[model samples]
Target: MMMNMFFYMGLVSLIVLTLNSKHLLLMLMSLEFLVVYIYFGLFIMMIYMNYEYYFGMIFLTMSVCEGTLGLSILVSLIRSYGNDYFQSFNILW
Candidate 1:
């Protein structure tokens, strides 16, 4: 089914983000893909199961919050370091 495909794509994107630490942009892209897929899957399930509108609204809210937080974090990270590379995060005391 389409839902299953989206779920698998989200899972794969998460895995790719976890394994590849070189490109922060790629990681962000993967994160966005995962979130979108999750949203799509949830939307499909709600429609198929005849859920209430509140559930869909909640999911949309969550997706918005997630996107905002992720973009903020990415912006901060980029500002701190001139590049969007995961390896640039080095904390030393």
Candidate 2:
């Protein structure tokens, strides 16, 4: 039952990430949500399979790094352009 709930939450985050990607902050938040869901799923799987938690730790570390990178990028973008909207995020700039 708990697993199913987390699965649905992950699905919702994925849908939000797909449908509403206009703001960098929102996208990053959804990405973080997905990462959290993945970590939870991994934890549950490890418990059920009686596997070592080393992989989960690695995954969590990587996720945290990714989140920090995303936030840094967002901060830089905001500083440069004063907005987080993807509409103004020109690739050629």
Candidate 3:
């Protein structure tokens, strides 16, 4: 029960962070928070249901890949433009 509450709170925080974020790094951090919350929630559900495996391992693997890709893009952008702000990447400019 407590774990579930924490998981929900984490999700809510993730949403709020995403909505309020103004930079790419902040957005990425919020996304990471969401992923962590999802993993925790899945763990709680598995424990309560006595499930041996939730097959969410694949989902986690994907998230890791996504994080790596996002970071790589961010690094490349920063190296090229000297900034990490998403608003700085103007397609017209």
The order by descending lDDT is: 2, 3, 1
lDDT of each: 0.79, 0.91, 0.79
Q: Show model 3 residue runs off by greater than 4 Å.
A: 1-8
> Of 2 and 3, which scores higher on TM-score?
2
Writing each residue's lDDT as its tens digit, candidate 1 over 1-93 gives: 865776688779889989876987787778878777777777777888998778778877887888788788879888988878777778511
Residue-by-residue lDDT tens digits, candidate 2, 9-85: 99999999998889989999999999998888889899999999999999989999999999999999999999999
Q: How do all models score by TM-score? A: 0.75, 0.92, 0.77
What lDDT score is found at residue 17 in candidate 2? Answer: 97
RMSD of each: 2.6, 1.5, 2.8
Q: Pick the candidate with the highest TM-score.
A: 2
Candidate 3 has its poorest 10 consecutive residues by lDDT at 13-22
- Which residue pairs clash within candidate 2? none
Model 1, residue 52: what's the lDDT? 74
Q: Write the per-residue lDDT of candidate 3 for residues 1-93, one digit (tens) a residue.
A: 886788687878677686865577777777887888888778778888998763678778989999999899889888988988777888526
State which candidate has the highest lDDT: 2
